[model samples]
Target: MNDKKLELECLRLISDGSGIGYINGIATFVTGLLPGETGVVAVYEAKKKWQRARLQSIIKSSPERIIPPCTVFSGCGGCQLQHMTYEETLIWKQRWVEDALSRIGKLKVTVKPTIGMEHPWRYRNKARLHRESTGKLGYFKERSKTLIHFEDCLLISERMNRWIRLTEEFLTKGYPEIHTLTFRENDKGEGLLLLEGVPTKALSEEENPDLFEALSREGLRSVWGSDSEGNLVLIWGEEMFNQTILDMPFDVSPLSFLQVNSKQTDVLYAHVLAEAALTRAETVWDLYSGIGTLTLALAREAKKVTGIEENPYAVEDAIQNAAKNNAIGHVEFLKGKVESRMMKIEEQPDVVVLDPPRAGMHPEVVKRLLELKPQRIIYVSCDPGTLGRDLRLLSQGGYRVESVQPVDMFPWTQHVETVVCLNRKHS
Candidate 1:
């Protein structure tokens, strides 16, 4: 195939973060192009069936196209749909979820309208920045190995932005071994920092005692450092950073999994609880529970809530969260793999809530659910590809997907969070 500068119209935005077009009957997937837009593309990668191209020039732009506000919009992988309006992104996200359920899962169910954020900017509470050997600190370029250096990121909170600058300055001085720096802020207006570097090099606190003190005084609740093995060691501070979710206080560690958007998380959890429709007499099992965000919420209404998680740190945080919230009697946290624990559950739950990672639920867990036959299941998924596959298996295992609600947790990005409710039919 020869490179051609032919006019092509983009078909649709696919899950892999690209727009589809046809050139000489060969499907082309290119970034920075939207549906209904006509652009001239330069073919870069030609495969047997589909080809990847780079946009040369836009002859006709889509109505949804807008001037992105980010300085590194094209290079940074932090966002994908910055070229389109927020409303259009939400619509496209919902459609993608529906397409996965229908085309991939083979389920003919109504996918409810997407729940969007009123104000979508500067909502991210965490930033993981890559540091170059030359002391350039920023995010990695989209679909490439290049690191795009920046003084600040527009997506994270204003406070975290300044903290990022502070870390960049601190590392630029003498810490050439530090490869990546991560910062996270919570609702309490406090933040934490983690420094990760090469395996051979160790984090030396003695070298930068004054810098550590200054960072702690600058509002970092705690500072941690790590090497290639990815284990965190406390460098300074004893502040137990706590964040409130729906009026319950939960302790957040340096590296625990958290929903990046704090405000939208309130909205997302409300939908999950609503779909649960608990009667205050049900026993609920929250699988893959992270810091008891959903477990504590469910504990308020359910008779008993048992949460099983893989992270021991998160499990400890969950226990402290339950005690801190003074709602311990109704909730319990167990540390282990959820798959192995699923088989040992002698007392079946009336409801099961799964907020698994992007990979979705495990096959063994799905198999165990078929055997347990829980009355109801609420699955919150971040990746639609895995979500579709799990829903297909659950549907085959006698569960029916009742409602699908898409939440725009990370606005201006291609990622979307979905909360699905499934009910089992009487056999």
Candidate 2:
């Protein structure tokens, strides 16, 4: 009930970048505070066990604290750890994985140091932003619909930033139908620009010429416009571009999943591949395979790799990618949820590799994995919370954690991508 300000020394950071502090034997989490810092806290929300507070002022701060470079750092939800030095950010991520395993997973497995980028800035190859009705391109403010229009973002690649400028200019010239814009560029300089417009509103026939002419100047490999239903109805150049990973070319579409940090993706996948330890005679099952990125990689080393994905679009791209990589004979793509399609396969795989989404694998999928009892299970996870929960279940089902490697895919954000390797217990 007290909104009165009280000074507290922050002890550590929680998952969402809030610092934990103790006041009157009760823990309170305050935003924008770092460990070893004394800050004046004002409680905004109080719960039974802890309270959420706002850092009013910092009387003392950590040595790692630094002024964020981005002009919209405080308001934009795009990046969270920009306030700290890049080195400190990596440290925070490593601690997060360790804490999640201990607290959430209730496991004592050792977590390795996080693999970070040597040059972390401007690494993002994909960006999703909102186009306001006022004809502005910007990101939504933190926890709010308010738009924070930025002239430049340090996280996006140089090509994406240029496209954003051209987009703003194009809108200023009178195109306000687009509600959301998602842009992606490959290392080869080819890019995909997707415009999502109001579903019910029909596009005026007269607007095509002017808009297409203006957009063509940006030199994107493809420009796709979709109705509110998200079905592509407009195409400029091509719908897909080629991206090379580990010297293997992939057909990357705007609809397909590609890691935003291309360089770190190779690093992360290399770790995953190493952890898989394929003997060239093991059958690999890649669950939630997107465009066969990992599936194709595993196909090169495994006897046969079967990929199960729900997105038919991505499956189409994955099939194409395998042919392009000349691994078609070793890999097959199936379009369906892993939980459902996995039950259809009669043969058991020697090794299973799954790169699940943030929510982690479905419970049914985990239950099935236990029934199949693959010798090795390599889980590529983006969210540690879900990874921890899943790990606990798998461990209880007789899987022993071998090692965990955390990769810093997003440098300035609180997000951490991890690869956990587990081996089934022997009788």
In terms of lDDT, the best-performing candidate is 2
Model 1, span 1-427: residue lDDT tens: 5677767799999975589988879998989899999999888889888888889999998999999888888877778988899899989999989999989899998887788888888788888888887776888887677998765577887777777776777767766778888888888678887777543324344777766666666677777776676676777665477777887778888767888898989999998999999999999999999899999999989999999999888998889988988887889888999999877879889999999999989889999998989899999999888999999999999999999999989888888899999999877
Model 2: residues >4 Å from true position, as ranges?
1-3, 198-218
Off by over 4 Å in 1: 1-3, 197-218
Candidate 2 vs. truth: CA RMSD? 2.1
Q: What does candidate 2's lDDT look like per residue over 1-427, in tens digits?
A: 6779999998988878878988997899987888899998898888888888888899998899999999999889678788888888888898999999999999998999889999999898888888777678898887888989998899887767888887776776565667788988788766787776643323333556655555556556667776655566545666568888877899976677888889999998899899999989999999999999889888889999999999877998999999888997889899998899999999889999999999998999999999999999999999999999999999999999999999999998889999999999997
C-alpha TM-scores of all predictions:
0.95, 0.95
